[model samples]
Structure formats: C-alpha cells, structure tokens
Target: MLKIKKKFGIDELVNLTSILAILFLAAAVVLPHVRAFRYFALIPWLRGIGLGGLFVFLILQAWIHRKKVSELFGHRRARSGANSALQIVLFLGLLVVLNSIAAGHRGRLDLTSGRDFSLAEQTKKIVKNLKTDVLVTSYFKETNPSSMRARELWKEYSYLSPRLKYRQVDPDKDRARAIQAGVKRYGVSVIEAEGRKVEIEGTSEGEFTGGIIKATRGEQKVVLFLEGHGEASPNSQDQENGGGLSTAKEAIEKQNYRVEPLSLIAHPQVPASASLLVVAGPKKALLKEEVSAIASFVERGGKVLLLLSPQVKTGLEQWLKSYGITPDDNLVLDYKQHYFVDASAPLINRYPFHSITQNLPDSFFPAARSLSADRKMPEGVSAAPLLETSDSSWGETNLLSRNLEYNEGQDKKGPLTLAYAVDVEKKEKRQKTRLVLFGNARFASDGAFTAVGNGDLFLASLNWLAEDEDLIAIPPKPPGPQPLVFSNGQMMQVFYAVMSLPAFLLFFGGLVWWKRRRS
Candidate 1:
C-alpha cells in the first residue's frame, strides 16, 4: 500500500456538494411540477449515482498517485462555444422525441383545418345520441388525392369521438378485404351502424360528413303529385312544344324524394308519410271529398305546394280560399319587365323578396296566374308573398283568347301578387303546416328549368315545404364549357400588330444594319 495525501480543496468540495444538493432538490420538487423533467429526473438520477461512485473511485486513484484532483478530472478550462453547440443539439433531439410521443407519430398537429365549426353543435347532437356503434372505414388508396383528403376528414371525425374509428384500407393491396367491405371505388367512405351501411361517394369532407349526418337522421321526403286532373305526370309529354315538368320528376327523385302521382279520386286518403302534396296545373276541379281531405291535411301540420295555371277550371280555388289563399282568374302580364319574342308570349321577370326567390336570378315566367291573399289570415296562420309583378304589370282576364290587348283600368296594376307562402299553425302541436302557392307550375317545366335559376327556385320552395332545406342538393358545378374567348380576327390582329409586327420590324432592321456593317 502506498501512503498518499488528499489535495482536494474545501471550496471544490463545497461547490460539488451544493450542486448535488440542488440537483437532488430539483428532482424531488421541481421535476413533478414539470411534465418534461419528470422522466428526465429518472435518467439523471442513475447517471448522478454512477458518476458519484466514479468520482470516489477517481479520488481513490488520485490518493494512490498522490496527484492533484484537477489532473485526474482533466482540463478545467470551459469551452463555451462547444458546450452551447452540444446543448443545442441535445435540446433539439429531446424536443423531437417528446413531440413524436405526444403526437402518437400521426404527423404534424394541424388543428386549423377541419369541418365547419358551425356543424360542430349539430355533430355533437348526432354523436351523443347515436344508439349504435358507427364504424367508418375509409377505403382510400394513397394514389388518389381524394383519398388523402378523405383521410384528413376521417381524422376530424376521430377527434370528435373515440367511438368513431377510422381504418384505412388500400384497395390495391387489400383487394380481398376491399371487395368484402363493398368498396367499389377509391375515395369511398363506408359508414355502417346497426347492420345498415351507406356508401357515400365523394371527396369533399363537408359533403361526406353531411352524408353521415343524413344517414344517421335522414327522413324520407315524399312529394305526392295530385293527379286525376290534367296535371302533368312523371312520364307526360310536352304537348305545347314548351318545357314540361316531367323532367323535374327525375331531378326531385335524385334528391331522395319519392315522386308518386296521387290521384285523390282513386286514393282519397292522403299518405301519412306524404311530406308535401303538389297540385300542379290542374285543368279540372278537385272533387268535394278531395277538397275536404286537402283542407283537413292543411289543418294537421301537413305541407302543400299549390301551382295554379291559367287553365285551372276547378273548385280547388274555393278549397284554397278556406285556407286564406285566393287565386284570381287572370294571367300575370308585366309590361315593364317581360321576356317574349312577340305579344302572344308574355314573360314576367320580377320576383318578390322571399327566401325561395331571394338569391335567384331574373327568371322568365310564361303565362303565369295572379294570386292574392285575403285581408285577414286564418287564426294562427302566417302568410308571406314570394313573387310579385312590377308596377307596370297587369292581369289579363281573357288569357285563353291569346289577344294581347292590355286594359290598364281593368287589370290589376303593378305589384300583382304571383306567389305566396302560408304557414297554418296547428292547434294541437306547436309546429305549423306550410303551404306554398305559385302562380305558374310551368316554370319548373323541363325546357325552362335551367333558365335563370327557375329550377332552383322551384326546388327551394319544395324543400322549404318539406322542412328539408338542409338536404337541398346544390346543383353540380357544370364542367368548364367553351370559355368565351377572343375571336380568330381578334387573335390575328393581336399576333400581327401587338406581337409579330414589332418583332418582324426589329428583326429586319437588325438584319439590314448587320448587312451594311459587313459590307
């Protein structure tokens, strides 16, 4: 054994002891306060213990060698630059690891992009009251951009609730599973609950999420076309060489509404699930029993969309009177705002300010009837005008004769009421029954449907009546048509005068100068 002297200074021992004590206190108290430091304390404690044992071992080695403690520990000069760089690298590494753990390796935490916040309240109601487990499997392949968009949407649904699980199945890799899951196409989200599955085909999160909401709480809207009169059927031909409502039936059906011809003569009892009853351009009168049934239906929270034509010869007018709606026997003719080739075809353009026609463009109404509300509405019933003729308009009493003579004093002046919506409050329930009366049904005819939002107005009215406004289908954005572009003459003029003329002059001038210089 060699006898050695301890050279460790009192100041060094004090400094080391103080640092160890502070670190221990920080681990005991501060580590619990900070979530990040709690795990760090574990590793630091093991390293400190091992390092402390090593320090004692080094001290023993120093004692044996009888040398300075500084010599055993190496140089004491601080390299600030190197220390800062090492600290920065360690901090960045720790931060990356911690973030990965927190995010569950699910990519960047993007809280900004999501479904409409306004829909959150509605979605909460749907999710909270869901009776069955809804398994939403998004069968999306990475090849398509829509699939990526669908995944992002599914992430929103998952964030809403843990009950909603999203499983990503690659159609190509998992062909067998995809076939079993009934995934016919890529970018398809399948929502299944209570043994019922609805495959909604769309890439838009709003559309896909809306479909899910509809799937959960969708009500079937049925539109009954009052037949037995000369009203147009779904298969009716356009006899007048003008547009017919036959094409509208297909459009309505596409909105998940079942359009069935309801001949009150054959079936007197109105279907209980009838969301709306449509009386379209009837040539004959409604039977007494049919009128009573309609009135009773109106009294019992039912919805009606009445479209009266100038050719209506029915007592349906009287039945409508009981509900405080009176259709005058005259065709609405607007002299100020009309769309027509000649005096025979009168086109009324102005519409009233109502939700149905609020955003609609200027429309052409051909041979529309005039309507008016009684001075007093029935008890608990509310009425609002939808469309009215301009101050220059007049009611043509002799509409069938096709005589284009306007009697100013005889006809009702401008602001002739053309359409109205009546809400009849049911005494039994707090809810009210809706009735929309339009002067003309032919506006929804196939030929005129696309003429300046006429079809949109008709669809909107029907939606309002059925109380299915949210389910109203937005018309698909038309594919890019031939963009109104510059004509050939304009293109040639631009090429020659603006572009080619200047370039040609510059080229010839440069060539002449080059030839002169060379000569």
Candidate 2:
C-alpha cells in the first residue's frame, strides 16, 4: 500500500480530494433545504466545501508534482492514464447507489415562500383516509402550462397514498382516449372512485381537492336553501356586490350534498329528505307562514343554518331568541384584525377546538352584524360562539352615520360574537335539533367565498349542521399571483453556474485529448 501510494504520490492525494468534492455535491442534492443554518445556507456551504477541497488539493498537488506537470503532454501514452478508468467506474457506481436511495424515499420538500405547493391539512386527511382506488386522468397537451403544473402537484399526491393514481395524455395525440372519456376540450381532470367520477377544470388545490371529495363521497345528502325572502340565489354567480351564494352552493355540493333552492311559498313544509336548511342573507322579512314552517322544521329535529346581514328585520330574530340565539341590531366593526382597507370586514385568525372552525385560517366577515348567545339557555339547548371579532372591535349602533366612531357608552366593545353553533337534544323518540347562526351571509357569497377562509367557514358550518364531522375538512387554499421573480444578482449567479460546468468539463477533455494525440 505504501509503495503504491508513493508511486502515485500527489496524484493519489488529488484523487482523494475529488472524493470529498463529490460527497459534498451529493449531500447538497439529496437533503432538503428546509432552513438556512445560523452560520450559512446549505447550498452555499456545500459548494464551498466542494470548490475549496478542489482548490486546496490542486495547490498541494502542484507543489508536490511541479517537475512532472511542467511537461504538459509530451509523454506518449503514459501507463498512468489507465488507472483513472477503475476510479471513474467506482465513482459512477457510488452515484447510482445514492440516487437509488433517494428514489426509494419518494418524498419532496416544498421550498416556496408561501408554501403554496404544500397540500392543506384537509387534503392530507382526505387522501390518507381513502377506502378505494382513485384515478385522476387529465386530458391536456404535455407541454401546456396547466398540464406541467398539474404533473408537478401529482408528484406529491402520488407520494401521499398508493390508492391515488394519476395519468396524463396529450388530447391532440390521443384523440381516441379523449373521445372515450367524453372530454371535448383540454385542461380537464377527472377524478374517479367507486364507480363515480367528478370532472373539473383548472389546477388549483381547491379545485383538485374538491373533485377528490366528490369522487370519494359515500352517500349523497340533501341541503335545501330557503327562497322567497330576497335571499341570495344559489344560481347567481354575480360577485360585483357580493349577493350570490353560488360559490357556497358549489362547496356544499362538493361534499356529496345535493343543494336545491326550496320555496316555502310553493311547498309550505320542509321536506323530510332535507339534511339541513340554509337561510342565507334574506333581505326582506320572511312571511308569517314561512317563518312558522321553518320553526316546525326545527321542532322536528331538523338542522338549520341562518345567516343574516345588518339593518334587516328578519322575522326569525325574535323566534330565534325563544331558542336561545339572539341577534343584536348593530354592525360589527374591527379596526385591528380586518381585511385590507375595510374595518367592517373583521378577520378571525384563531379558533377554539370546535369541529367547524378547527381547521380554518384567517377569515373575514364583511359588513357583518353581531349575535349574542344566551348565557341562560333553554333546557336541552346549548350554544357556542363560532366566530368573534378582534379585541379592538365594536358593534356600531349608528351604522347610517356618514362618519362613524365607537360611542363609549352606547356601543358594545371588543370581541363580539359573529356566529354561534347550537346543539339541542331531548330524551324522546324524536330527533335532536341542530342550529348554526352567522352574522353575515356575504362571507359565503361569490364576492368573498374564495377569501382565504371564507369558503371553508361556509363548508365547515354545513358539515356540522349535517352531522358529518368527518367531512369538516379545510377548504382548498385560495391561490394568489405568486410568480417567481429572480433578482438581477441571483440571475447572474445562476448564469455563471450554468456556464461554468460545461466549460470546466470541456477544458478537461481538451487536456486529455492533447496528451493522447502526443502518443
């Protein structure tokens, strides 16, 4: 060993130094860049380790073998050149082993600033609890932007569960497959499970997750929206003024619930098949008979969701008081936690461990009213607050005032209740009553439904009301314009890296060729 080492001399030491550089590069590529170390970032340190090893090793080799290197390539076919082949083969074998180990793990780390690539907690829950095989088929051009993005997302999904499979095809290339699947256009994803299929467009997490939910749903429940009191139409998609419940309706339907607008005037009684009743933002007063019919529905162990806007005389307010949920006649105003430029839209971030609000983020209620849950409740009735304003919020009595300020004595101060969940049960053969009350319906309207947490809030409320706690997962995250923009300095660094790699290899190749030609 010593003889061999002495014969090779500095060249052997230089080869050992190259091993260090390769190890550093391999580590940098394999490990995830989750955080920057206190001393330095992972990539930069790895780069420094590799380049520094090469530099120091080269210096030592130059000093030791100065006499030998001085004669560039005059030697004819030196026997020493054959030794590199064995080392090269061994190096390549090491790389194959490292990459195989990495491939076996089948996991990836998201490095986006907003973590947009990361799946929501709800999506994980849905995928992990899958009971059957699911296939996601996409009809799109391979090079299309949406197809590429969907494929990237599917890489994570494929790792999440073995039950979820994905396949993509270029519609132009596979016209027969596209036609068989009933897909007429591109950019469509069909999630199929248990003989059911949900077709969707777009590549947002919310859109894909929603399709999974529908495809995997077991039973179809019914949600009836009360009409005829100027309530927001379930079919209206107008988002200009925020008076449409269409988005909310779609969200409910995604959870395997069939949503239908019910006109009490046409059929005075709540149907027996209704899983829940939604009275969403009624502007005009409900007729006496209509209000009576809703009361009858609640009395018979039915679930009800009542969402209200401020300054409206909803006749059910007094009726609701009898059941322990009271409506305050004021607009909730929050100066601290609110949407951008609007204090009227109180933003709620934290929540108690209730099933509805447990998995939600910062949500805002626009032009909302206040609801007071009765401390002294009726027998077999209990209420819990679902949504609340910030500490600096207030309930304004004079909503019509041109310039509004919190009245010290007249107005209510800070952390007012915006919504409540009421549970009712009795020791009888009849079913128990469940109720969810909200201060504002516009939170679920088309204008605000896709807000960070607005749509989830609506869906969670429905889940609780329908007694499907398992379905109370978080809604799809609302994606924003998060285009990756590189700085000029960063771009220049990347450019140098891109150019230097091939340049180094070409120079080495030229040196090798010059020596061989002399042979």
Candidate 3:
C-alpha cells in the first residue's frame, strides 16, 4: 500500500485529469444531443474545461519531465518524428477544409448508362434561371424506391439554384402536411411559386418540369400552324408514315406553348393573338388573298416561321425577297456533311451563336433546299444564318439529275445557307418582327423530329420567335429503369469490408501507442 501510494503521486493525478478531460471533450462532441448532457447543460462547459485542464496538465508534465523531454527531442530521429507529427496535423486540417467545402456544394456524378438520375437540360435551365422562390415538397413513403429516387433528384435541383427549396417528408408520418398539400397518395410533389401551386404525381420529367414552367410562366402563348396549303399537321400521331408533327407539337407544348392549326380559307386572316405563324411545307401554292394576309400578319409585328422545300412554291418567294430572305429553287447537296451514301441528308454539326442554335447539337435536314439573303438587307431588317452546309456542299440547280456532281458556274459554290433568321424592327409601331426560314420542312416532321438536335431546333426557333428564349434548352427525358439490388454474397462482402476496416485501424493505432510507450 505504501509503494502504490508513492507511485500514484501528483504526476499520476494530473495525468488522470488530462485523460478524463480528453474523454469528456470527445463525449461532448459525440454525444452532442444526449438528453442527460443537455439537461445538465455541460456541452459548452465541457469543451472549455477540457481545453483548460489539458493546457495545465501539459504545462505541469513538461516541467516535471523537462530534462527527459529535451533529451528525447535532441536526437535526429526524435526530431524527424516530431516533423512527421506536424505533417499529420496539417494533412488532417486539409481534409477538414475539403469536407467543409463539399458540404457547401452538394454535387455528385451520375454514372449510369441512361443518365437515369440526371436532370434534363431544360429542367436545369429553368431552375438555374429561377426568378422567384420555388418550394418543392415531396411526399413519398419511407424506404420506398421513389423516396430515394426523389431525394437524389432534389439534391441536384437544390444545387442548381438557391431559389429552389426542397423538403422531403414521410407520407405516413407527416399525414397532416401531406393532406394539406393535396397529396392523396405517395409519389406526389407539390411545387409552389409566386402564390401558385402545382402538384406532380409521379417522377415524370415532363410533368415535374412542366409544373415549374407553369408556376413561373403564367400566361401561355399561341403558335398557329398554317394548314390550307396542305401543311404538315401538328396533331398527326402517325410516326410510321411521317405525316404528322406530333413529336414537334409535344415538344413545343412542353415549353408551355399552345399549338393549333390555322387555315386562311376558313379564317381568312391570322388571329390578333397569334404569337407565331408557322408554314410547314405548304404542298399547294398559297392563294393571292392568303399570301396578302400572310404579308399583313408579318407587317403587324407578328412572327413567321417558313419551312419550304426545293422547287416547292408557297407563292411567298417574292414576298420573302422583300424581307431579304429567298428560298432558292436549288437543292442543297452536302457531300462532306451528309449521312452515309445520302448526300442530300446533310448532317449539320456547325451552328452560329444565335438563341435558336446556341448549344444546338448536330442536326440533319433530309432533301433540303438552299436559302439566301441579299448582301444588302432591307431597311431596319437584319439577316443571320442559323444553319448552313459545309464548304464541301453546293446548291445544285439541276434538280433533274439523278447522278450528280458539282457544276462550276451552273451550280452555286459550297457552304450555302440552309436556314436564315431575319429580325425587323418597325420603329414607327414600336414593334419587332422575327422570321425563321428553314429550307427543309421535313426536318420538323414526325419521323425526323426525334433525330439528334432536330426537336431542339424546332422548339428553340419557336421560343426565340415568341421572345421567350428562357424556355429554350434540351427538353427533359423520361426516367428509365433504375434498380440497385445486391446478392447475399455481395452484401456480406460489403458488410465485412466496412466493419473490418475501422477495427483494423483502431487495432493498429493501439499497437503503435503500446510500442511507443514501451520505448
């Protein structure tokens, strides 16, 4: 008893206090929300006491072991050990800084073959450019696949814009909130903005994003497709026959635009509320009255989209010339840019930076005609090329030739313009008139609308004409099958790997401490 009392002196007492202080500090951090600690209000005091006690104990221990401590560090190997300790501290600090930054920016890469977890381009644009606060509340059952899925999507949406706020609640536990949000069942997402609310039932990209659009964009604009001259029908659902513009219409409507067919023979004039006038490959020629009415529509500061084909006349060529746009009678042939063995189906990868073609990918126009703008434009009218052929393509005037090569003088040189955008400002009326002329109407037809960038081009052009360029980007794609399942063997392997690693690290650390103490 006397020997033990002698060994457990003030030095041992101080050492025990220091260790207790460290354990208390760790408990304060790890058990921050413990009811007992909070009731006693020891969290803040615990940290301060731990720090003070550690400082005092360190000072006393250094004084008691002053000679031994000095001798320990005097050796070159001991100094190297001190340097290694400093490097470890610095590395830990760097890791803390990185984790802090990562917490601020919640981002992750979605590595899936179908990009199943990624937000659509159009959705990204809308959220990033949010003008007002949007709150998206998700109602999904806990442990449901949809709950996890919506959370992953909300993480991305929240990262995009600070204005977009997301909240997830278990439908069963939060029944009161769910009922208030009109979420009768799970998988409903309520989006509220500007005193308006929209509910989305499922994870459909179209519905989810379309709700945001409606909440942001209040009033919808009308897009009128001219029909009397046998224009391509926007209501056509026949993808097999390539008869309808159904795909094109669906894309346009997704941007919150209303599409309807207009006939000059029935209505005799464009509606005053018509936001855009589309003439999609008018097979028959327009009557003189119809042509006059179309001109009047353009003069009244309305937008017009003309999709013409080679050698096809809508009787608007002379009228188009007045606006510095002429649909050339020659066929456009791109030997360099066209698809395999089909020189006429030119794959246009190049684009000028206009709102219509900004970020637009490669688009193909099948059996397209060439268009030209006069070197000097009409007064107050500006012309810009939206789509063009490569320098290897030319305008072949001899449409009768089946087997063809470029003719030097008889045919126009390569790099002919296939599409032109004309902007006319009527200063007297304080109104602006926009025109988007494409030499090929087939590009916007049903079968071809799904081609790469083809649908984006059509939708973008309409948005530009309507002066709603905010709604332009690649539209969202429907979610695909996403299943993450593991077998028993894989689960066991993962479990053991996760469990064994920390145990191994802790064991290794203890062994190192024991060896150092023994030394």
Candidate 4:
C-alpha cells in the first residue's frame, strides 16, 4: 500500500477526489428537476448520500495533505487569485449577453402536466393561417391574478404569428375605453379582425380560438325562436321555473349567430331568410293556422329544433309521428345513484357516432322525458338517437305514485332515447330539411345551463340545426391543482440522511481518536 501510494502521489489523489466531489454535487442539484424523481422514493436518499460522501472526501483530502497543497498552489497564491477573479468577471459578462439574446427571442418549454401554458392545436391552426391582423384587447384590473394570467396566455398567440397582437387595458383606470369597447367585466377578451369583433368572457384556449373563428367568418347564421304559445321566453330574466333561455342565447351568440324571437301568428309564413327555427317547450297547443305555417316551412326544406317538456299536450305529436318520432308522456328515472344527482336528474354519457354528439362530455337532464324511434324509416326520411339513458334507467308510467317503479307492460325498459335527429329529403328542392327533437327543455334554462357539460351540449345542438357542424363543441381545458404528498417512512428516511449523517460521522471520529489516545 505504501509503494502504491508513492507511485500515485497526493496531487493525483486530490485531483481524483475533487472530480468525484463535483460529480456528486451536480447530481444533487439536478435530480429534483427530473420527472422520475417524483415517483421514485429512493432517488432523494441516494442524492443525499452522494452529497455526504463528497463532503467527507473533501474534508479528509484537505486535512491529510494540507502541507503539500500549500506548497503546490500557495507559493503564487496572489497571481492565482487575480486570474480567477478575471475569469469570473469575463464569465459573468458572457452570461449577461446570452441572457439579453434569450430575452429578445421567445422560446418556451411547457413542463406542466397538461401543457396548460402552451397553445392548443385548434388555436395554432387558426392563428397560423391568419390572412388579416387580429387585435386582441384584454379588459382587466392590474391588481388581479387573472390579469397576469391573461397576459401570459396572449403571449402564446402572439408568438405564433406576427399578424396577432394583444393589448391590456385596466378597466378601472380607463372607464371610457371600457365602455366604448363594450367590456362588461374583468378579464373580458375582445378579438377584432376584418371590421368584425367578438367579446368573450372566458380565458380558455378553446374559447379564444372559437372567438377568432366567429370574427373571421364570411357570413353569420341566424336562429329564430318561436314565441306566443306560452313557451319559455327569451326576454325574461327569471332563471328558475324554466322561464328564461338567456344563457343559451348568449352561448349561441358567441358562435356568430343571430338569435331573434319569431311569432307565426303575426307572420303568414316562416321568414325566408331564417336559417333555423326553434320551438322551445310550448305549454299550450298550437292553433291550426300556426301549425300549417310550420308544416309549410318544413315542407320547403327548412331546419327546425323542437324542445318539449314531459306531459305537455303540444298538438304536433301526430305530425312528429309522421316523421317516425314519438315523445313519450312518462318521466325518466335512473337508478344509478352515482350517475345522477337525484332520482329526477338522469346523467347521459353514451352517444351515437353523430357529428353533433361526438366527443361530448357527460350531460345531466333534470325532469326529462324519453323518445322512441324504431329501425323502420319513413320514405326518404332518416332518423337517429342523440342522447340515451343507461341500462339502469327506465320510464316510470305512474307519475302520481310516490315510489315510482317500472310496470311490466306499461313502463318502458332501459336505454331510452332523450333526443333524436331527423333529416328529410325534399322531392323538388336540392336542400334537405333537418329536425332535432329533445324531450327536455329545462336543460337549456339559464339556471341549469352550466350544470355539467350542458352548455356545450346546448351549443352543439344549435350548431347542428344551423348546418354548422364544423364548430360543434370545442371546450377549454383548465389546469388542476397538484398537492404535495409524502409518507411517514419517506420523511423519516430524509431526516436521517440530511440531519443525522454528519452528526454520526463526527461522533464516530471522536470515539476513534479517544480510543487511540487511551492506547
């Protein structure tokens, strides 16, 4: 051992120990950033052990060969110190230049679990193909956290294209500008392009991208709602009792749609410029002339949406029968307690392969009925189901009973349809008339519109009725909160390694020295 030590001098040993110390220190600094370290419980302990071993090696090398190290580097210590200081100054200057260059050019590494800070694919597709400049104005208060997040989000869009730019205006400071721009609340985003503008109150990637699509469209679609039959009123602000559809109207308007209340009693026929007509939850039966006008509209290849509540005697049942759709007069009850909030609200997650219901989230309909559609079709008419209840659900026949149970012959079995879409071919015209029927109108009421995915479902149905299936239902993704988790055993391991190792080392060394002195 002495001969080997002579061959490999103290200088070589010191160099080797210094390299090991640097490697261990680098591992200790870099391991926490790794994704695998979060799942692997032993990585932190290993890092701590490496750091402790490096500290021990450094102290032992310094103490054993203190004279040799002093002779090697201390003779010209002033010159060495001067060179090190100059090198550190040069390194700092280089780092500053690099930082300035990096600041001017935008480059982001979205390390979040959901990539929440990055732009979505749908947003990139719209921004990258911009032919005109899009000016996005944000109305926010500088003191709010939403203002900071909105600024961060708009930067992602701006980085994608030069034609896209954003400006932030504090609503409190600039009250006139806010009123002029029609800013209703904080964090409202107004997107303008080609002399058109859209105001969106949501900050999701999908909402902003949808606003861009609406502002840049060539033409707007019009959706007319029928009134005067004791149906749900659009002008009413009362949310409960299913008296208002204001939230549904706002959702449709966000897609560049023009929504207006129409009455067939005043007009002889449906308006020629109408793209889609809606009959929402009529409480009274339609008169003969009004029914004839609606029939004429459908006969001439028009699109229509009908929402009927349970047990309402809307006299158009026979006409719907001709199209092979039957709106049942029973209540839908689901025994799946986990899927519904109560027995009245049936949750639906299953859907057919249709453009309207594709990729839709789970929807909950409170006090809804069911529809019936057979495999047999009418001549040149095609019909399909949109939403259906689970196998644990059934239609209750006796509404008067306190404890509702399915009767063998009277009540219907599971998997009942709640909505249906029907398409009819016109013999003389090139266009097809489309009809969508939902058994529940309360789903779109202002009070229950945002219950679950009910808002997206409502918008998607409107898009299908207006023949704008391309923009069915694109919703935003929000980031979820992440919590810190550690087990008691893991915490104990960490404490022993970080707090106890050095104390143990000192005690062991002291015991050895005391024994040697006694000998």
User: TM-score for each prediction?
Assistant: 0.59, 0.69, 0.74, 0.63
Question: lDDT values of the candidates?
Answer: 0.66, 0.80, 0.80, 0.76
Instruction: List ranges where model 3 is wrong by over 4 Å.
Output: 1-92, 106-121, 204-207, 428-431, 477-519
lDDT of 3 at 100: 41
Residue 296 local lDDT, model 4: 81
Off by over 4 Å in 2: 1-98, 141-146, 169-188, 237-240, 398-409, 478-519
Global fold similarity of model 4 (TM-score): 0.63
Q: What are the root-mean-square deviations of the candidates from the true structure over C-alphas?
A: 12.8, 17.5, 16.5, 18.4
lDDT of 1: 0.66
Candidate 2 residue 340 C-alpha distance from true site, Å: 3.4
Residue-pair clashes per prediction, in order, are 2, 0, 0, 0
lDDT of 2 by residue, 231-281 (tens): 888899878777688878777776778988899887789998888999988
Candidate 4 per-residue C-alpha lDDT over 111-182 given as tens digits, one digit per residue, 9 for 90 to 100 = 985456677544675677777878899998999888888888787887677677788899899999999997
For residue 116, model 4's alpha carbon misses the true position, in angstroms, by: 7.5
lDDT of 1 by residue, 12-108 (tens): 6655655675566455455433422324325445445434544554555556565554453464444455467669967975775565355433333
